[model samples]
Target: MAGVVKTGILGLDAMLNGGIPEKNQIVLAGGPGAGKTLLSFEFLYRNAKQGNNSVMFVVEEEAEKVLENAKGAFSGLKDIDDLVKNGSLSVEGLSAVSNASESMRQSSYEFGNFISDIEAIIADKKATRVVIDSTAVLEILVKDPLMFRKSMLALVVDLRRLGVTSILTAEMSSLEKQSLSFRPEFFLFDGIIMLYLSGEEEKRMQSMEIIKMRGSKHSFVTTPYDISPAGFKVFAAEEITQE
Candidate 1:
């Protein structure tokens, strides 16, 4: 009861002062290979071990490939695969290529059905933690901004009704400033975690910042982080000491 749900990432919970709040939607934003997907997977995977069921819905990747890639990131992730086999955890991936080929056009009902499917899985798995890897694909799926916003609102509201603490991964632009590729999705969520990749050409480094966290005291500094065989590890960027 004290700990809502822990992400189990090194130094991350330390910075958050605990973990993400339950029954709230938090956006995880980053560019390609910036460790957004890994962070989401790790959070859900860790939840499964803590007796809290978890679910993941990937809109741009294959379900099998997602699990395979996750296995490589965290050796302990073998347990995640086991949960899938044992039906303790549920995972789904709706790739742009596949979903587009099947649906032909993006409609509210199609998006509604996706939300229904996710809801069913949450109930079936008794999931308390949910992750949607990369909502950026929504831009391509729903062409109209208003339509996209409506679809996202419906989805988020339904997820909240299920009493799930959800984390959605979004792909941010490479530019220094924030881009408005999927701005509508941000307004519906309760929190935002921004992953920043800074430095010139060859010396680029990844940093994590809790941009907006509703009803919580969050970190303001951009802390450094890395992905390894274990999972994502956040660290304070060390100053280069010069004599």
Candidate 2:
């Protein structure tokens, strides 16, 4: 069987037909407070629980803080503090880089360094699953779409080459008419998952739509999902539409 990586979200594997394809790059696009971080954390945290080495490459959230937040999200998460302290779960891009953009200029280095740091982590940890918390950081760092696309392509290529199945989270605009500037990422990655929060009449609902999954079969409908203390749980819309 081809090596496969599970996302750790309940019912997500079924939607993707069998988890994220081996050696592929997938994007988790959503707006702030849309459970992107929570979902990605569940993904990596579950892998660690399964004895599969994992790494979380966070550009937007601090490494230490991310883990701290994850504890509340996954009640069974073990030794995250020790794992981070012992270098099992490594943190990268602590400091911002130069001329990258307003968002990244504060970091000690540029996005390139962040990518390299992730590569090193995979080699060191033998990580099978990875999550780049927010690729949107690059959108702010590189103003030109062409340059942004090239840099993103390089990072995605490098991650896949390492045999790492990665989840890249991105922030989207709340408006249906106002789209994200980094829409180009859909082309740069292997799969695209879009999360949206909207109200139909009087009820507010959360929906997860799988836009594309190259080389694999995936559900075509917008599934309902919820973020809770246990992490993200995806359910068939028909079954949960009442909420």
Best by lDDT: 1
Residue 170 miss distance in model 2 (angstroms): 1.3
The whole-model lDDT of each prediction reads 0.75, 0.73
Candidate 2, 97-125: lDDT as tens digits: 22223435565455576577667667877
Error of 2 at 217 (Å): 1.1
- Displacement of residue 67 (Cα, Å) in model 1 is 0.8
Per residue, candidate 1 scores C-alpha lDDT tens digits across 1-243 of 424566888878766657787788899987776788888988887777777788888877688898888887787545676777766566776643235435624353366666777777678778889998877766676778888889989988998888889998888776343552446579899888888777777787888887777766666777888787877889943342222
User: Worst ten-residue run, lDDT, model 1?
Assistant: 96-105
Question: Per-candidate TM vs. native?
Answer: 0.85, 0.82
Clashes of 2: 7
lDDT value, candidate 1, whole model? 0.75
TM-score of 2: 0.82
Report the backbone clash tally of model 1.
0
With candidate 2 superimposed using the best TM-score fit, by how many Å does residue 223's alpha carbon deviate from the native? Answer: 0.7
Shift in Å, residue 228, candidate 1:
1.3
- Candidate 2: where is the Cα deviation over 4 Å? 76-110, 175-182, 200-202, 237-243
